[model samples]
Target: MLKTWQRCTSCCLGNKHKGDFMHIYAIGDLHLSGEPPTKPMEIFGEHWRGHKEKIRQHWLETVKADDTVIICGDISWAMSLEEAAQDLDWLAQLPGRKLLLRGNHDYWWTSLAKMQKRFGEHFEFLQNGCIMVDNIAVCGTRGWLLPSAEAFSAEDEKIYRREAIRLELSLQAAAKQKPAAIIAAFHYPPLFARTEHTAFTNLLHNYGVQHCLYGHLHGENHISAFEGLREGIRYKLVSCDTQGFQLYKII
Candidate 1:
């Protein structure tokens, strides 16, 4: 039987395993223990309604204790890390070793150093950082959205430019280590337009990211979301809107 789960305003994913191979399971924009009917719910509600048990059931059923799980962002609504610690503890109880990245709504995320130290025991966070599990290297950023589809004002361009720098920094850190297969992640789609002129894409291509994952878009957007390989890079949109997270075979 599948394991049952409970919800909490503060959640922290658990990270621990006693296995040889490292498996990666991913989910994004969980917005768990947050204001109800908020963005996360708008995206995953239809599927999650009266189904919290089902979602948790899926997690306990699908993931093994030794697997590596990545929660892309929007983890909680705490105003500070201390408050976050309360929520993070909830995430710690579930199975697996968990990795986390920042999300757009993560208003309380302090310096990555501080957050890492606080949650170091249960969660490993990537902020312009990299880590190796079972020899597979994982690197990621709280990637920002490119102003595609619509034209951007000067201010919008400035914001986009700033995020571009941050993204590159994260990539640079990951590249320095030269992991076997670069697994890049973000909260937004690095390429949502036809033009490959975007800064995020430029960096991704430059780093030769083997696989990229992202989340954020929800609702009807999930249907139109991109999934599969583009060129040599395999990109998968792992938003919770897509029913549930995915189990990736890195081999």
Candidate 2:
């Protein structure tokens, strides 16, 4: 059955409630493949074996129908929408409303309209807009690598600036709602390693975002990703592998 909030179709902006949510959870980098798995994640490490089941079990144990889960990105291993059916179906069966953002590896993600039409009833996609979950505003974009990164190219600079503009658009939408708090999600770490801030991080500060969730780093790369409080906003790395395949409660 659809929850009261799910009944509204105005892109999460129309839904309003009197109280706070039961909880808000987040995790990312699902990288799921259909059964008879073509892109096995175990190659990353033995701990990745049976990762799908691990995520399912943890999700079932932690979330309720009333809660929300922000899936930061890298949601599937499929190259196209048709190929992603099985993985999408698997996520659809889980409990709670899911908010998805784009990841660097999400080639299956086409236009927002197509994705929403396919799974909007159970999932909310955050592109160049924001969603109001009760009094808190959920905003995000697929951020790009910082200019400070090694081998940064002119093309990377273009994409980086474009993503920063997209994030600002989402933040502007959220500000109009006058939400009690703002939470930003990203597929890439907004800030580079050993760096204090970037365009993405500065935007969060400008918007008074209380929390920021991100993913993408894995294995040894995880060591360089920054987390914890920075200039008031609490940033967290929620990659599925980093979190032991468990949902990290944000509320």
Candidate 3:
């Protein structure tokens, strides 16, 4: 169950007070495979057995067609775009406009133009870019593992720096729009379990981002993820399992 602070009353179904307000919600690490799931996440835990239905039910109950849902990453298990069609179609049938960030497991992801053309306007992919949601700007990239991680290698450092540049580019683009607020999303946590800060967190702070949402941590690793207010910015982990497969309202 969600704590009181994590719950939003304004976005519930049939709420008369919700007039003209477009709510934004987030959840990530969907790990969906086509209908006959080739990669059942149940192997991770029994809690994932019927996750798709759980997500759909909660989503329908929370999000409206005009609302926006940001999916942080690991959206599908398919190895290629052609193989991911079924999974993509499943998401298309869900309510709300979705903004997707690439996950490490999302090998099916190709160029942004190809994905945009294939999916149309309903699904927007974020990669070194920002999307305007009402007066707010949503910006992000597939953040890599922090250098502080014990397993970090030379190659990991290369990817980490590249992702940092991408994040800066996205933030710069969002800054240009001068939106009322900025929200940064990522597939990997910006900081390590014990580390206080990293390049990713610094970029966020420099850009004056208000909230940061990320996933990728799961099961026993959940305890290590950092959350709550830090340097005036709020960070939250939105992995599907962590949220009990429900969409978290983010204003």
TM-score against truth, every candidate: 0.79, 0.91, 0.91
Q: 125-146, model 3: which lDDT tens digit per residue?
A: 9988899987678999999988
Which lDDT tens digits does candidate 2 get at residues 166-244? 9999998988887767889999999855456799988888788888999999988988878888777788999999999
Q: What lDDT, from 0 to 1, does candidate 2 have?
A: 0.86
TM-score of 2: 0.91
Q: Candidate 1: minimum summed lDDT over ten consecutive residues — where?
A: 1-10
All candidates: CA RMSD (Å)? 9.5, 6.4, 5.5
Clashes of each: 9, 0, 0
* Regions of candidate 2 where Cα sits further than 4 Å from its true position: 1-21
Residue pairs whose backbone atoms clash in candidate 3 = none
- Best-first order by lDDT: 3, 2, 1
